[model samples]
Every structure is written in C-alpha cells, then in structure tokens.
Target: MARAHRYTVEVTWTGNTGTGTSGYRDFSRDHEVRGDGKPVLPGSSDPAFRGDPGRYNPEELLVAALSQCHLLWFLHLAATAGVVVTGYTDRPEGTMTENADGAGEFTEVVLRPAVTVADPGMVDAVPGLHERAHQMCFIARSVNFPVHHQPSTSAADSAV
Candidate 1:
C-alpha cells in the first residue's frame, strides 16, 4: 500500500503600501512564504509583472523543484548501482506561454546535469541512470508538461 504525505505552507502578502490594491500600480507583489521548521522564503511575481527582481518567483521555484527531485533520485540510484558520484550540478530551464488573458502554462522543462564519477568505467552508465531518475522523479511525474534530460558525465580526476 502507498503512504500519503502532506506539505503545508503559509503565504502572507507584505505589499500593502498604505493602501491595499487601490490601483494597478499602488501595491507591491512582495510576499513571504513560511513552512514548519524552514526559513522564510521571499517571494514575488516575475519582474515582468512589476515585481522585485531580487525575490524568488513561482516559475523559477517550479523549475528548481523539478531539478532538485531529479538530482536526489539520480544520486540514490547511482549509490544503489555502485557508481560512486563525486560531484553533480544542474542548470535547468523551463518555458512558459502566456495567453491573451494573462494566464500562462509551462510548455516544457529541460534538465542539464553535469556529473562526475569516481571511476572511468562508470561514465557510460550515467546516462541510463539519468533516464531512470527522470522516470522516478515525483515532480516530473506530476507535471503536465514534458521534462527532458541532457546529461554529461566525466571521471573524477578529469572533471573540470
């Protein structure tokens, strides 16, 4: 039987600027996100929507979640397969399309992972491991858009 897990977060709007939503440009888009035992996350709309560029946006967070889930699953599978991972990093990107009504949806996300392994012989197995990790990622499975992977691997001593 599968077990259920729950996650809860509280979002507080901190952008009242003396008046609340009095006009289109009167309020800010800044907000605070908090979870139990976690540091408060500063959040805002994308800068294109008049939000502060320094704060985290929802679209960026979505891409990060996908990347993080894939990374954890990949590491676990590598350990189980006896492939020693030395270092790993990913720069993932997501594409979204907005409609005339100002609504938007993500079309796709690409995960580019650069991995370094301890042994040269393990390099060839890394791509297949990434495939398995994509198949197992919870965020990827939950998304309506496509998640593509482009992975590169190198032996530890030769890694840059």
Candidate 2:
C-alpha cells in the first residue's frame, strides 16, 4: 500500500516599495518562506532577474532539495547494508535553460558525492549503495529532468 504525505509552506512577499507593481521594476522580488516551528527562509529571484544576490532563490532550493533527498536515502541504505560511513559530502549542480519568453526549466542535476567509509572493504559497496539510493530517492523520481550521480569513495584512516 502507498501512503500520501502533505507539506505546507507559507510565502509572504516583503518587497512592496510603496507604489507596488506600478512599473516593471517597481517591486523587489524579496519574500520569506515560513514553515511551522521553522526559521524563516529568505527568498528571492535569481540575481539575473533583478533579485537580491544575497538571498536564496527557487532554482537553488530545488537543487538543494534533490541533493538532500539523495543524501538521506544514501545514509539509510548504507546503514542497513552494514557499511559504516564516516563522512559524506556533496557538491550538487543543476543546469537550467531559459526560453525566449523568459521562462525556464531545469535540464539536469548532477550529484557529486564524496563518501568516506570506515574500512577498505566497504569502499567497493559504496557505488552500489549510491545506485540504490538514486533508485529510491523520491525527489529524483518526481522530477522530469535527469538526476545523475558521480560518487567517489575512500576508506577512513584506521589509525585515527
């Protein structure tokens, strides 16, 4: 049987510069994303779209969501497979193409994960674990674009 999960987030715009939307550049694309009992996330459009470069944008958030999902699933699978992972880090990148009409969609996302295992014996199993994690990632399954994983595994220092 399948289960359904619902998520809710509230976004409040805070960029009304007095005369709201009076012109093309009248308002800022600043907003706050709030979830129950969570810290407010500052949000804005991409800097190319006249947004604040200091704030997080929707495109970046999407990529982060994908990366986070994969990481969580990878850890869970690693634990269940008896692979002791000492450290894991990812530098995920996403590519988006904009149309002539100023609309865009993500083309692909590449997840570059560097994993350190507790033993050399676990190194060989890391690649298969990443594959399984990708197969099980909900975010990767939900997206239309391709999600690629390039993983590297290293054994932790036994002396430490």
Candidate 3:
C-alpha cells in the first residue's frame, strides 16, 4: 500500500486597494502565503500579469521548489555514500511557454548545481549522483515537465 502525506497553506489576498477586482487592471496581485509556525511568504503573480516585480511569483516558486527538492536529496545521497560534500550551490532555470489564449506550461527546468567535495576521490561520484537524486526528489517527480541537471564538481585536492 502507498503512504500518504498532507500539506497545507493559507493564501490571503492583500491588494484590495479599496476596490476588489472591480476591473481587470484595478486590483493588485499581491498576497501572502502562510503555514503554521513558518514565516509568511510574500507572493504575487508574474509582473507580466500586473503583479509586483519585487515579490515572489508562483512561477519562480515552482522552480525554486524543484531546485530545493533536488538539493536536499543530493545532500542526503552524498552523505550516505561518503562523498563528503563540503559545499553546494544551484542556479536552476525554467522555461514556461504561454499560448495565445493565455494558458501556460513550463516546458522544462534545468538544475545546474556546483558541488564541492572534501577529498579528490569523492569528486568522481558527484556528477553521477544528480540523476539518482532527481529520481528520488518528490517535487521533481511530481512535476509534469522534464527536470534535467547539469552539475559541476570540485575537489579539495590542491592539484587542481
């Protein structure tokens, strides 16, 4: 039997401006995402949809969720395999195509992770680990689009 997990969040729109969606361009897209015991995540639609550019958009959040899930799994696998990861950073990117009718979908997401290891022998294992990590990532598995990773690795060895 498969297991189940539950997750929840509260999204409250805060951009009434005294007039609530009175017109297409009248209301702001600003909102707050809150969960118990967590900091409220400020949110908005993409600026293209008349949202605040400074706030976090759902598109960006989806990409971030994918990247974060991959990172967490990668770290766990590296530690278990004794790869001794000393540092890690990811510059993930996603592409969303919008149709003329206004529907949109993310075509793909690329996870570009730069990983550093504590020893030279651990270097070889870093690149191959990304695939396994992606496979194990919950968010990556949940998404419809392909999630590809292009990872670069560095060893602490003074030779290079």
Q: Which candidate leads the pack in TM-score?
A: 1
Per-residue CA lDDT of model 1 for 53-149, tens digit only, reads 9999999999999999999999999999999999999999999999999999999999999999999989888988999999999999999999998
Q: Model-by-model lDDT, in order?
A: 0.95, 0.93, 0.91
Give the deviation of candidate 1 from the true structure as CA RMSD. 1.3
What's the C-alpha lDDT at position 118 in model 1?
A: 92
Query: Candidate 1, TM-score vs. the true structure?
Result: 0.96
Misplaced by over 4 Å in model 3 are 157-160
Q: Give lDDT for model 2.
A: 0.93
lDDT of 2 by residue, 13-126 (tens): 999999998997999999999999999999999999989999999999999999999999999999999999999899999999999999989999999998889898888888
The local lDDT score (0 to 100) that residue 45 gets in candidate 1 is 94
- Off-target runs (Cα >4 Å) in candidate 1 are 157-160
In candidate 3, list every pair of residues with a backbone clash: none
Question: Candidate 3, after superposition: displacement of residue 62 in Å?
Answer: 0.4
lDDT of 1 at 127: 88
lDDT of 2 at 151: 83
Q: Give residue 158's lDDT in candidate 1 (0 to 100).
A: 74
Q: Name the weakest run of 10 consecutive residues (lDDT summed) in model 3.
A: 151-160
